[model samples]
Target: MGERTKKQKLILGIQHTLAMFGATVLVPALTGLNTSITLFCAGLGTLLFHWVTKKKVPVFLGSSFAFMAGIMAIIGDSRMGDPDFMEKLASVKGALIIAGLVYVLFAGLIKIFGYEKVNKLLPPIVTGPIIIVIGLRLSGTAINSAFYYNGEFSLKSVLVTVVILTVVICVSIFAKGIFNLMPILFAIIAGYLVCLPLGFCDFTAVREAHFLSFMDKDIVAQLLCIPQFKLDAILAIAPIALVTMIEHVGDITTNGAVVGKNFMVDPGVHRTILGDGLATALAGLLGGPANTTYGENTGVLAVTKVYDPSVIRIAAVFAMILGIFGKFGGFITSIPSPVTGGISIVLYGMISAVGVRILINSRLNFGNSRNLLVAAIILVLGIGCDSIPVYGAVTISGLALAAVVGIILAFILPEGDDSVLN
Candidate 1:
């Protein structure tokens, strides 16, 4: 990829954009945030990430699914046409900004203490289940979104989802070489075409949408946060930054492994974390969801064997172009609900499967009581309950609590083999 012609880099960049499209837009769609702004922020954020890290890594930053629960808890309702939606969204943005700061704190800790300590503290036993929980916990939303039709299940959506799912899965398993790298993009094209004939999508919004608009329009002028502060929102959401930080390490580790370099050590983990943190803060400040090292884009890098950072930066530029054009954003927002559902089914499941892979790859001995207890507790704590009461009328919940619990258990419990999962 590094030696490719300029035209080839652009083509690969477009492919990377397509890989990130489904999951990236889904965050704004679910949280009722401005879709165009999200895209714009993602682009700007990626550029910022590159600058912060001295432009060494090829990772593309995008919307993070890990913070969905916190966003939902704060301002996530998509009902009543969302009369107060922006008000709720603005508040969430405030929390997300703080969360980004928390990410910086973790980055500093990593910089000072080094990766080995963080790795020992987190280990695959803790982080793997947390990843699985992040995916499995969102399963209900994925299914419900696919089947939902004016408050009723539709056989139409089911057929559509199934078709798309099948296409994606088949391409994933059977496609050879570079072809396997683009199943999501191909499947989406196939599904959207299927949706058009079935009357699942509305083209009217696209037609009515403006060709050019700044920041996704001035519609939410009042809702834009000028530093709206909420301690509760901070407490609810900020800690999850740490959870995503662990994920950042894994994502970078995976990217490095695939590209045949140790990004965690070369560009330095601290630099990468700093880049991600600043990018996320930019998203938060702009009333969008938090940003993270997108695993989907990393997957594309792995499959395509494109180690060049130029392609990802190009993809980031593409995202910004879509963001500045209101019409492109509108079309993406209006993608039929069920089409998203189909993608989510595969995506969320793949996430959980990655967790299982983490365990298998790490060789975490389930027969060992310590490993069993830690993993089991993290799952139940993460999926079974949303939060735990930590103070009078206050609670710690979501991935933050789940991750903290897992880390504590992993640290305190005795290892029968006196081993670190791997």
Candidate 2:
């Protein structure tokens, strides 16, 4: 590759930012976390990840969907006028902080025992199904939000949602170049425009928001309280690191494949995980969601064929700059639920599809009773069981439950050689 001009670099950076913007903001929008803080953490986390990996890995960190369930479970109904809402939010952050520390702990173990051992504990059959469960668990919520508004069906909401979903599908299938890599952003724009004419949007918050407010009230308010380390919330949310940790490795490997370099061998997987861990911890402290490696940005890397870490850093800086714009945050939060829901349908399905791809790539034989049992148990536990009570208040459920059980089954079950049976 030849040396690029400043203008070229700027455009590339902006393209990368747009690629990540939709999914990053969507997490906070869904989980009732602050959009501004999520953006700031994503940028900060990406920078932190790059620094820890010695600036060798070209990747961006964004709000993770894997933890959205835990977040919602811990901090239910954030819009409700509960006097203790802040306290509940603090507990959620505390749990997320623990989850980040777990990543660091795993990173340390990987450094000592090697990633091979960790892989043995979380093979494709185990990790892949757990991932599928994560997406499926959210499927009902996505559908309900898309088809209804506050438990009632609305024609306007459905119309806007259909338009957004159609735009996302068309862009994903038909758009060319950089635009093809940004279905989510295009869907959001299309949704916003559609909502405007249909009377589905309320722009009051955006109208009242300041153009350039760095120290916004939301940030200030979140900063005032220390994160609460409640045992129940911690137990519910922290164990999810097992699932996302595997995802981090997958993302890094995919990014390396795109860039034609082995990031896992160079900067090392441990360092990358450490970077992700520390970034997520910082986010929890600042009242934001957990951070994970973003595949969207990696897709951009593949399309543009620009593997420069500097370009990714430039995108990170753009994210942080946008985080300070109060109006941008307001506008994002004000998006109609149906539009968000429509985009989520594709997003959630894509997540499950990634898991399916993992299984397909591994070519796991479902005819083998061990493999079938492991996957079936994980699917049922993840989607069917809401929470498994462990103690007085603490419980393990959802993705965390499936992840824990899958690892155990993977260890104990004996693999019998069987042909792939359809």
Candidate 3:
């Protein structure tokens, strides 16, 4: 404390904001939630997270990809420009609110029983396959959006998509320093630039967009109000919180590793979980996506070596400022679909790869039929989700079904005792 100048903190604050900027906006961009509302909720959520954690941890809350499937299930391929998009999105908002409560329940359990006791329920095998399903299940939307037109795919769309995708891949694989961390933002820029010359971009919306609107007109009337709850959406979405809670613990542990301070022990894992729940519930209530602690900003802290919570608070303030200005959100909305699609290709694939890493690091033994069976059923249920839903509430087919099955199997399946097989 009292070690750095104000200017240094401000610079570090802006850097933190930039680290989270790309991914924070991507959720709304992908799912038809309001960009400004997402920003507003993210900023507010981060502040609430700090408050709940007693302002000790330096984590930044951002849009959660884990909830993307739930959001899409509720919204059902509707674009933000659609007349009824807001109506559909309201249901998803309700789902996220219920899902947030799941975190609170976990927090209570952790406080009473401790982390290891809770871990008995969700091991790597179960959580890993559930995560893989979340990513793989959403894979088709990434592909379809890459080449999508008014109602059909086209060659021009493919060309634009390939260029942006290639650019993002190169940046992610080869670019140096911070550039490597920001492939999404750069790829979107690359796609927009390519589209300008190829006539894919429509600047009419951007031009006609008001210079300064304070969340007025259609924005306030739709996304800027209180989240409306629906039972159908809550049932559809709340189940996902089960999976993401595992993710939350992983993120907290990772952040602890980076900062060399066991956040799970210090600020306490229960508090962190409660913080996330509060932040997520607040975001959902405001019609934004779920909020989770972002690993991206943790990377920024590792790179910059600035551990001040003040810096992250500064970034939260900056996010709020950007959110309050409606035009910046309008500009984000003006970005073409191909741009978001190109980024999704890399983002979605990386999510699945993370699951693979989890399984690999955990040394999951396929020799145990239990492990194999759990993984197998999860993958089949998740990937086959698309066709399965046509027969029923298909919403249950994806991550939701796989997660339930994996949990039950993990609970009853004797822990791969080789002696039993022998």
The digit string of per-residue lDDT tens for model 3 on 1-422 reads 34767876676676566557667888987887777778888888999899888888888999988777778778877866687787886777777888899899889989998866655766778767766665576567667777886658877778878987787668768887546545555666778888888777776645655554443566565555556688777766787677667667756655655466768777788999999998898888778899998756655554445677887899898787667775654555556766666656655665566667667767777888888898899888767864233222323345556666787888898884551232
Model 1 scores worst on lDDT over the 10 consecutive residues at 215-224
Sort the candidates on lDDT, descending order: 2, 1, 3
Please identify which of the two predictions, 2 or 3, would achieve the higher lDDT against the true structure.
Answer: 2
**lDDT scores for all predictions?**
0.76, 0.78, 0.72
Q: Is candidate 2 or candidate 3 better by TM-score?
A: 2
Give model 1's TM-score versus the native structure. Answer: 0.80
Model 1 lDDT tens row, 24-50? 888877877767778888999999999
| TM-scores for the candidates | 0.80, 0.76, 0.70
Residue 396 of model 3 has an lDDT of 35
Positional deviation of residue 380's Cα in model 1 after best superposition, in angstroms: 1.8
Question: Which candidate wins on TM-score?
Answer: 1
Query: Given candidate 2, what's the lDDT at residue 115?
Result: 65
Worst 10 residues of 3 by lDDT: 387-396
